[model samples]
Target: MKQTLVIGASLNPSRYSNLAIHRLVQNNIEVKAIGLREGVVTDITIVTDKINFKDIHTITLYLNAKRQVDYYDYIISLQPKRVIFNPGTENPELYKILDENKIHYEQACTLVLLGTNQY
Candidate 1:
């Protein structure tokens, strides 16, 4: 399983980001998370700062396209193997940037992918 980073993570259990964190852990995939406010989802701490994470194979975004603008460079800098747009988070500008940098990306739902064993 790929080591994944869950961006826009939330403390709220109802948020998909929170659910994804739990699912990823349950599946035995190494996972890290970040969000606006510091909190915990299961045993994973939701980091509030933008720190570079090494050896990250994938980044699944939960923020909307607008909210994602600030993290574009930060995310690209991480240079993960791939970025998952995760439904409403899709941004053409970021896609172009990723394409130019030879980074792969997918506009899909993380939960769906996990449920179908496609993640």
Candidate 2:
């Protein structure tokens, strides 16, 4: 199974990041959630830091562009096969870095991808 790291994950039921967690698990994708807020979703506790991540196949971002700057190095170091910039999370600078690293990137919604059977 492809292991995905859900950046900006939240325990709030109303949040897209939380929804992504549910959707990813439903799709049989393993998920590791990283966020400042700590709580459980579907019996899995959300991790607060990305420093120990390894074998990340994909990273689906839930954070907006401005808040993403501080995480650039962290994300890049994960060396995932791809990064999905869902909706409001798009960043050209980050895209450039991913491009330089030969990492695949897509600016699209994770929900849409799951709904469309493209995830």
Candidate 3:
């Protein structure tokens, strides 16, 4: 499986981002995480900055719309096959920009997708 970057990842176990990481890993999916704090989620390292991740087939967002604004350019630069606007991260402006760049995207739940084997 190609890599999936989890933006807005959290070290907090209760967070959906945290749960997603464990699920992704268990499903044998490669996951790269970006969070406010640098830490480890199981074997995955959560970095605090944009590090130009490569071969990223999917980017699953965990940030809210406003917070996501800061990553618009960075996300576009990654050129992932698709961006998953998970729950609270949906942004219309970013969607337009992605459309202009010809990047595929969807507004859905990452965990749901993975759980259903539809990811």
Candidate 4:
């Protein structure tokens, strides 16, 4: 199974990123999370720093396109198998970069993918 990184994670229970983290854990998936604020979601701590995560299979983005700009190079450095552009986080600029690097991406909802067993 691929380890998932939840970017733009939130402590708010209502947030989809938070929900996705819970669901991912519920499905026994290893998950790491990072966000602007420090918080905990289940057993995982949402770190404020952009730690260089290893063996990251998937990166589920929750940040908006503008916010994503700053992390473009950082994310690419992690070399994830695919980047999931969850809803409002899609960016064509990043998509082009991913393409140039031969990285795969999907413009889809993480919650839906997990629920449908397609994650």
lDDT of 1 at 86: 88
List runs of model 4 lying over 4 Å from the truth: none
RMSD of each: 0.8, 1.0, 0.6, 0.6
lDDT of 3 at 60: 95
Q: Could you give candidate 3's per-residue lDDT for residues 63-104 as a string of tens digits?
A: 999999899999999999999999888899999999999999
For every model in order, what is the number of clashing pairs? 0, 0, 0, 0
Reference-based TM-score of each model:
0.97, 0.95, 0.98, 0.98
Residue-level lDDT of model 4, residues 1-119, one tens digit each, is 88999999999999999999999999999999998899889999999999999999999999999999889998899999999999888799999999998899999999999999999
lDDT of 2 by residue, 1-119 (tens): 67999999998999999999999888888889988888888866798866667899989999888999988888888889999999989899999999998999999999999999988
Per-residue lDDT of 69 in model 4? 89
**TM-score: model 2 vs. ground truth:** 0.95
Q: How accurate locally, in lDDT, is each candidate?
A: 0.92, 0.89, 0.95, 0.94
Segments of candidate 1 deviating more than 4 angstroms: none
- Model 4: which residue pairs collide? none
The residue ranges of model 2 lying beyond 4 angstroms of the native Cα positions read none
Can you give the lDDT of residue 36 in candidate 1? 89
